[model samples]
Target: MTKAELVFIPFPGIGHLVSTVDVAKLLVDRDERLSITFLIMKAGVDSKVDRFIDSVSAACKCIRFIDLPKDEHDPNQPILLSFIESQKPHVKEEVSKLVSHSELSHDSPRLAGIVVDMFCTSMIDVAKEFGVPSYLFFTSGAAFLGLEFYIQALHDEQKVDPTEFKDSDAELVMPWLTNPLPAKLLPSFLLHKEWMPVFLGQTRRFRETKGIIVNTFEELESHAVSSFFKGNTPPVYPVGPILNLNRDGDHNPRSDRSNKYKDIIQWLDDQPQSSVVYLCFGSAGSFDMDQVKEIACALEQSGHRFLWSLRQPPPRDKMEPPTDYVNFQEVLPEGFLDRTIEIGKVIGWAPQVDVLAHPSVGGFVSHCGWNSILESIWFGVPVAAWPLHGDEQFNAFQIIIELELGVEIKMDYRKELFF
Candidate 1:
């Protein structure tokens, strides 16, 4: 009898990779007979992502990493969907080879199926080529999945242009959702003609997969999860609340880094239980100097202890990092850090999961990344939804308006207003 194995192909982004990796770990844990092969798209070199992969591979022998063939795509390209679309041929080739080897080698685990990230739906053809099943592992909630399908259906069947209502205040109706969705809450991709087709095509391809695996539980999005099977759609599995709990020892040990970690922990320890607020945007999030000053003023007025993970905005020349960057203090208000030294800790990067797990973290001021929102829910910390862009607007609506899990923070990036 051969061991069962599944191949996971996650989107290159860190957020997508992390969640799918969590799901992969859970699958291996549940069944010792199962193992996973994680195909990393050679998108680019990222230090944090590489460190995470190294740690996970060290911890779990059952998980393996394979680097896909690299291409010369422009790192500064504004449209990511085009890049993902171009990689289909390479992905299909790699997946075919792996599937063939699994079948041929007696010692290798038998190929069970190929699990693909929602962004990489093009791999469905690869699965069919090898006569293996394909599954979509959505990193976000089922509600978002439901919305994607609804958007695609409208585009195909009704010939509705979502971008037409980009500036409109009209409400849109959907069968799965009880409340009317505001036009502004739609994902940003719908507003752009170029990206719309890529997204819609991916959603339409969802019907071709064996099933969809979502990173949420039944209690969280019962309506959305239930709506998937209203017709002949594939089975939907909500097997998550998947978190990276054991990430403490993943980093290289350092006394200086250890001291900073201890200092932050000690600060939290001193605060009253459930009294402090933690504010962290995702890795890609940042603010201009004007916005930073306003936030500083708000924090001062609130008189609350906060741990803010701050990063400077991407360079104006292009939405990419410079070879060398200036200190965070250069972008903050003059003497701002000095005044807030006692009440706040403005760090460059933080161990987000660990920080959220802290007992003193009462509130989370988030950019409303799906992963961050789920982490807040898992830790029982309340969220102050401050969505930046992309799918965050709809996610904020889901949490603040639909489920009543969090409160929405009015975001007007250009206006300099204190909270």
Candidate 2:
């Protein structure tokens, strides 16, 4: 049988890489003749992403992994785009080697396509170099993807900048959504002109792809998924709820108290059913002291059984994962831990899927991350979205304001941290 090969260029972040790996797994599993090679790129000191290399490589024999050569990132350029562009040459070289000299290659190469991450559209040129099609892998839900299509068309094709109207209290009645989306709830990238160019450039390239593979399903987002059929957008495949249910293969961000995985589970086992509120923002989700104090105060006063996964913010401008707090006293409000000690548990680096799957977890207070939202839905836990950045605010709107699957603590709260 002839072999069909696919090259995956996922954003180096752990969250993006996880979903990208899931897609690779699905493709290879569904086809006997297909094989995928993940061209892993280096990020600034993430041991978790390294674990993905180890875990994913071991779990699936059909899938292959290749580490792209490291290069100096341009400091002036934007972080995500900058790192992706710098690896263009490495990607090109690796693809050349794969097509020409790999053991899997036959007399006639059947190179299929390149699958680039949502943020790594800069790799399209590399895909075009090989005369192969390029597909985009979107990690978010279908509703947010539709929003991007509308906003991009509004700005580029229609010649109206959406950022200019962000200050106003306007609601947009979009076809995909039943309710109006507050202009304030639009993505932070849309609200800021400086950030507009990067996202706009990406959405512009969305038109360039052979197709888009978004992580969602029709039953959950029928309106949003159906709208794509009527638009001038790329073919969108809503293959989602792509979760790593296997605990042995699950990828976690932090390494500290690795023992806490079992400990937390045991603790939850003792709690009353559906009584605990699980507050785990995305891996990079964290806050400053003032915001931490406010969260502590709320949790303390509410007196509900809670599990908060708190990580210290990465140092300013650094691209590393958030570290475990050395001292909870300095960070938490005075007497906050003691007062809430009986009702709650504070730990570092949660095994999100496992925690969400626990019966004790009643509701999730999340960063409104697409993956986390899917997990919440899968486990039948309602979300209380408190988005930090990226497409989260828009995702917050979809779940709370649009579908009403959950409530919102705040929609417009953008994180103050630069990283």
Candidate 3:
């Protein structure tokens, strides 16, 4: 019997790629006969993804990394889409070329299939074209997937305008979901009538896939997962807490940078179990000086020990933070760091998953990225959800309020402030 060659197509983002890569690693680890290849987008290749790929490849002999060219006609270039039409043909061509040129023998091993993220459903067509089975990897919870699918139905029934539903106060109560979700708790792409075509196309692509793999375990979302798969024909696999699969050892790629923030772990180590809070807003989320100051004040006022990642705000030529506030650390309530030094550990970036998994991490203040939510839940850490933009608000709602796993911080959503 020959081994199987599996290729994974990850969505072009940190959260999606990270989750998919973990799944690929798990599959390779379980089956020695499996060879895995991660196909990343050209523009999507960055320091973080490259570092992770290097680590995985170095750790596993059968895993490989490949980059696909920038699609000439990417429909989702400026805006995220329900389906990525333009990238399909280019992806298909690249996959075919890679398989054909590889030296693996048919007698020794054979092309197995492609595993694709839910958002990149366009890859389904490519897999079909290549005559390889493809599985849909939903990089979100079953509840959100069900909500998105139901919204598509509502769009078809003309019960509501997709654009109007975004800001509307209408409560969406789906039979397949655990609770009623607010209209605002949906993906922003659903608000664009222009996205209707792509949305439908993407849904169709999902229905056509061989199977669906979700990044949630059955223990966490039994009802939602059961409801979702009961209505669909494809096999649904709930193989998760996948983020916890990797052990904290010397294998960590970021160990060198880990020392730069040893004070963080030391502080957490000092705290009582489930007493301290871990704060991280993820790589893409940002705050202006005023917002940063407010958050700093809040944390200081709460007198909670926190570890915050403060990055240089978007460049002046690009999106300026605030006119009154020139520096990020400047806006912190005066002597903020000194006052909280006993309790707080402020660094530009910290080892996120490692921090969350620590025994002392009581709760998480997060931007509500799906991967972050899953990681928090996997480690059984509750969250204080503060969503910014994109699908973050939706993810926050699903995990915090809907799932009874965390709390949402009440704040004025539209207010913008200067330091």
Best lDDT goes to which candidate?
2
RMSD from true fold, candidate 2: 2.3
Q: Count the backbone clashes (under 3 Å) in each candidate.
A: 0, 0, 0
Clashing pairs for model 2 are: none
Assess candidate 2 and give its lDDT.
Answer: 0.84
- How close is every model to the real structure, measured as TM-score? 0.90, 0.95, 0.85
Query: Which runs of model 3 end up more than 4 angstroms from their true locations?
Result: 70-90, 101-104, 157-159, 193-197, 244-257, 312-334, 411-419
lDDT, candidate 3, at 331: 57
Better of 1 and 3 by lDDT: 1
Tens-place lDDT per residue, model 1, 51-77, is: 778778877999999877766555454
lDDT string for model 2 (335-392, tens) is 8888887889988878998899899999999999998999899999999989988888
Superior by TM-score: candidate 1 or candidate 3 = 1
Q: How would the candidate models be sorted by TM-score, starting from the highest? A: 2, 1, 3
- Cα error of candidate 3 at position 263, Å: 3.1
CA displacement after TM-score superposition, residue 263 of candidate 1 (Å): 2.5
For candidate 2, give the lDDT of residue 227.
90
